[model samples]
Target: GGPAKGEGQATGGCPVYSHPAQLTDNRNCVLCMTCLKACPHRSVEFNLRPPGIELWTTHQPMGHEVALLFLLWGAVLVHRLPEIAERLQLPQLLARFDYHALATVVLLAAPGGVAWGLYQLNRLGNPCLQGRPFVQVAYGWLPMVLLSSLAHYLTLGLTEAGRIIPVTLATFGLATAGPIWVAHPAVIAFLQAVSLLLGALLSILLIQRIAQQPWLRLLPLHGMTVGMTVCLYQLIV
Candidate 1:
């Protein structure tokens, strides 16, 4: 409904999905500081930093960011569930819509929960942090997590991404050649192993750098890192 008399007009907005051209047309933006200067709360600041080092730092994330990562992890699992189901020969019950819900919950509470718990383990090993939230240090562990994600997605992209193009094009009365390229199973396997092992090594180094404690004090969490990597290796390879 339109605004009543004496009410201010509603601001017009465009849906990103409906008007993707708006996002693609960045010509109107001239790097002007108008928005930053116009903010009432003065919450904006800018700084420069070295690339990619922040992911390995011990700095914790906000509560919502940690929660966001949990949800993202769940989404990632949902995206990969078909492959997972195929490998495990999941029961027919998984064909139901509820399976996505179940898988998301399981992924969030199980693997994602373990990653969050490691922040507590870090706290326990320190004992100096009494009142701080665990979310702070949790995302510090994301370098390996994100790297493994890249590796996983890269394999899928190289092997499977091209297949959809022909089907989509055919719907529009177009024809295409065979799949762009399909790497050999052995080659994909080799790349997957390299990515997983490299991620594992990076995770170990991240733990050592961020934990800054003797192994005995942080053994459990370190073990969690190693175990997670091993599970990932088994799952993918």
Candidate 2:
């Protein structure tokens, strides 16, 4: 059939894509494998394992994926802008626009800076590689960026998300056998510090691997990363 909408139910769950449950309308999939089998070009495939594993490893010409990740990271930065601005006591430079709105606009307008930096590093690292190096080298820095994100939000998430377990149990008329664990502020801080430092170190290592010690090129990126880490530590943690 041309359409799989009315097709028979699939055996187990939606194989619509790698992350069906993450979709807004995953409930409507009916576990149908139509999309999986109907592709004329055979572009569809399945990954039954954890997400982000590929990012943790080397893949080539990942510009599209890097773009998505940068957009996501931009959104994260926007989400925390209010707290950051408040903590910094920054004045509202744009009177007519919401600060957060302006921040988001900035993200949309200039999201490729990270990839561009990566491209430059790649050029310096490997002269023979003909492909644009942005996406390829960008993957190497993902660990640093993601770990920074975790360190930034660790305290808040541990406190807030931990309640979901107890709340869900109460909603179902069930009981928790023990009190939910909340990380002490000091412990959280220690973890956050480690995460920040680890992210910086990983980024340094990635830069080295890509360029075999292109110190001049790396100086700016390293400073930026460490500066952002310090800013986050001072403001949020």
Candidate 3:
């Protein structure tokens, strides 16, 4: 039988039952392959698409989803907190709080606060813009959030990942001093810079597409994207 009524079913059956094309926007899909295995017509399939394409497409984002996007953005910054605190000489000021607690606050507050400020600036520059500015612009930053995190993790993967060989051998009591391959720090830094640049470009494009506003009004968000790219570059590299 087809997907049941009032069960959150839409135009297609993909477990979540959202239309197949809309799966990019459906956060509930767990990719369990239930529909792929069960479809009688064999019409279910996967297609390769550009990352962050969904950010520019039509989808009504919920409040929680928007909030989560900010959280994800903030998470990328959370990893650099130690270096940040050190450079700014904030250890003494922050000594009263636990490290984990401070990180939690940064994770929860930083991105949202920045976004809110940018949204207000954008609205101030163009008062005619309509709708909830925060929700409207939230998804536009997804590419930045995702690629920055990827770039951050790429450093670990490139440098520390080689240790898995010797570490695994040690775990099995077969310790050896044979050389293992690790990418050069310079190479990793170059790649991280490239990743951030690409993310910033995609973010600018997505913001333009999503906002549909004049360049003058969009300047604040564009600046924010560029600023974030620079900040992440400094933090990671």
Candidate 4:
């Protein structure tokens, strides 16, 4: 077949391999299933491969899948923010404490969520293939996990701010930050914990839905029921 101009010809610093007239162009291979079945590492597959043939070295194949999974479930963490704000009356109470720190913490936690999700993906064999090595999953999730654990500390800050400020009636006095401190301080301490709990439950439920597993429906429902119970307890106390 005659080569069309600017088509088959290699251009722009293309390397020329002197061996068997194999086009030597990365783009030339057709994914004909030959190379994949032949690969010893079993890293190649039709789902991920282009229509023709190609070779990937050190293909962290699981990276992106894991990323996607984590991201999908992680969306739940943000989803509940509005409800949380409303349930806790965050907007009205915003003036009671140091929002600067709370906002900063939230900003920090958002990125942390993304990082942990990436890490979890890596741990699960990079289920989404984000290109980071599988071994680094711990380091990836470390920040979010630690920060999540400390979420309750945010309430402590609020309470501390209230205590330091001498304004009494003009404020809820020091009690403004009191809600966070006493309002199920354990739960408030780790907002991301709820995020994770719900996020994980959501991920599992989604998988169950796709597979139509009868048991999957209970996971989210159970989580919701438990969360509601906690909310009730917080309110009563």
Model-by-model lDDT, in order? 0.61, 0.61, 0.76, 0.39
Alpha-carbon deviation at 229 in model 2, angstroms: 2.2
lDDT of 1 by residue, 1-237 (tens): 114333333323222222223333322355544443334444567767764454445343467766776565555556566777877888542687787677767876665677657667666667874533445445545655675676678777777775777767777878855456677878887887788678667666655655555656656666776786676677666
lDDT tens readout by residue for model 2, 1-237: 123544343343335444433554333466656645544344556658643443334334445777876666566566666775666676572333777577666754343575476467756775664542455555556666688678878977777676777877877889764367687888888888888788777876665565444566556556656765676567556
RMSD (Å) of each candidate, 1 decimal: 9.3, 8.4, 5.2, 18.3
Higher-ranked by lDDT: 3 or 4: 3
User: Backbone clashes per model, in order?
Assistant: 3, 0, 0, 21
Worst 10-residue lDDT window, candidate 2: 1-10
lDDT tens per residue, model 3, 15-57? 5565555565656877776555444454665699876556656
In candidate 3, list every pair of residues with a backbone clash. none
Best candidate (score: lDDT):
3
Runs in model 2 deviating more than 4 A are: 1-58, 88-98, 107-111, 114-132, 169-178
What local lDDT score does residue 157 receive in model 1, on the 0 to 100 scale? Answer: 76
Quote the RMSD, in angstroms, for model 4. 18.3
